[model samples]
Target: MKMVFRWYGEGNDTVTLQQIKQIPGVEGIVWALHDVPAGEEWPMDKILDYKSKADAHGFHLEVVESVNIHEDIKLGLPSRDKYIENYKKTIEKVAKVGAKVICYNFMPVFDWIRTDLFHRLEDGSTALFYEKAKVDDMDPMELVRKISDNPDFTMPGWEPERLKHLSSLFEAYKNVTEEDLWSNLQYFLEQVIPVAEANDIKLAIHPDDPPWPIFGLPRIMTSQENLRRLLKLVDSPSNGITLCSGSLGANPRNDIVGMVREFADRIPFAHIRNVRVYENGDFIETSHRAADGTVDICGIVQAYHESGFQGYARPDHGRHIWDEQCRAGYGLYDRALGIMYLWGIWDSLERNKQEVGA
Candidate 1:
């Protein structure tokens, strides 16, 4: 596995490229032009600028976390064709900068949802927390205010500009259903998969953050079966997935290890992290240690090793440890620590394999 780190950008992130370089085994950055609105083609000069920065630090710009999908595309509006055309152009631009995998999601309204950004854990370190009750009971607008009012850094999915139309977006999605979402996603893939393939880039869709519908919004990328259906949508090697453990692990039913074994060839990127699920249906991000969370992190890594995975992997989300005031889930310290833990598991598996062969 080729380990990578997520860096927001120069001034937008607290963690620097210098710090990421110091992390052992991290060879690239999973990045995007966060300032650019979804559906618009990314500026070629800005893309080159990002490439230069990473190249200066000896990091490959192989993976992009997202080229955010326009709500028009997801909503299947008539304007979607324009956005889809722009998306095709964006794919070509990122590929020019040496991006091998482009990670995007089709989740409508919100990309990811969480109740508390800094929910304190038993160990005093905080992490992103998801409370099911809050989602079911609280108004999404209130939750939007809580998430979007941040002065520190822009949250990936909860961009203020997007949430500014929360009510309208929700109303627009009221008539949309799960099947409708699947059809819309298929429409998107049909148009863009050929562009991605032509660019030698795998278009990997991130699973819904909680792997479930929220605020009555339809979420289709939530389970193993749904993912299988997604792969068959385009039926091309370029059509792929960004398998996220913490996102699917929230439900406790998703067999992440099984998914790795089944979709190994198609997955160009993996987000390896752990989350502890409770009886009450809430979950909190935890250390990558298997004991710390419900996810079978060890087995998941083992599955990748067994499959001879040559794709990019990253320590997805981590706790707010050492009082490091940073992005809610994208901190330097704990993510670095998570990387070491993942390496420990992978290295031991390699050593054991060598021993068995000997």
Candidate 2:
């Protein structure tokens, strides 16, 4: 695995490239222009600018967390053609800057649902938390406000420009069912997969954050069966997934280890993290240690090792520890710690493989 870190760019993020460089085994940055709205063409100069910075730090610009999908495309609206064209252009631009994979999601309204951003843990450190009951009782807009309430940094999916139309967006999606979402996603893949093939850029669709329907929005990328169907949509290596453990792990039923092995060839990017799940359907992001959380991260890595995964992987989200004044789920200290934990597992596995060969 070529380990990467998510950086929000020079001015936008609290964590600096200097700090990221200090993390052992980190090779690249998973990034994007957060200021750019979905369905818009990325500026060539800005893409180059990002590349220059990462290059200066000796970090490869191999992956982008998201090139946000246009709402019109997800809604299957008539204007989707125009946005799809923009998406094609954006893909070309990112690939020009040496990006091998672009990680994007199809979840409507929220990218990743959470009841609290800084849910306090027993250790007094806080992490992103999800409460299932809130999905039913809380107004979607209120949840938007709660997450965006922090003026310090922009939340990835809850952009004000997008959430400004939250009520109408929800209304637009009300009639759209799970099958409708599947068809729309397939339509998107059909249109863009060719462009991705031409550019040699893998378009990795991130699994739906909670892996379930949130506030009645249709979610299709929630399970292994759905992923198999997704791979069949394009039937090309360029069309792939960014398998995220925390997102899929929220639902205990997901066998992430099985997924890592089954979809091994289609996966070019991975977001590896652990979550502490509860009986009440709530979960909190935890340290990468298996005992610290419910997710079988070690087995997942072993699956990746066994499958001979050579693509990029990143330590996903981490708790805010040592009163780290950083982005909510992304703090320098804990995530750096996570990289070490994952590296420990990967290194041991690799040594075992080498010994067996010898």
What TM-score would every model get versus the actual structure?
A: 0.99, 0.99
Give the poorly placed runs of model 2, Cα more than 4 Å off: none
Error of 2 at 337 (Å): 0.5
lDDT of 2: 0.92
Give the clashing residue pairs of candidate 1, or none.
Answer: none
Model 1 Cα RMSD, 1 decimal: 0.7
Evaluated at residue 58, the lDDT of candidate 1 is 99
- lDDT against the true structure, per candidate, is 0.94, 0.92
What CA RMSD would you report for each candidate?
0.7, 0.8
User: Candidate 1, TM-score vs. the true structure?
Assistant: 0.99
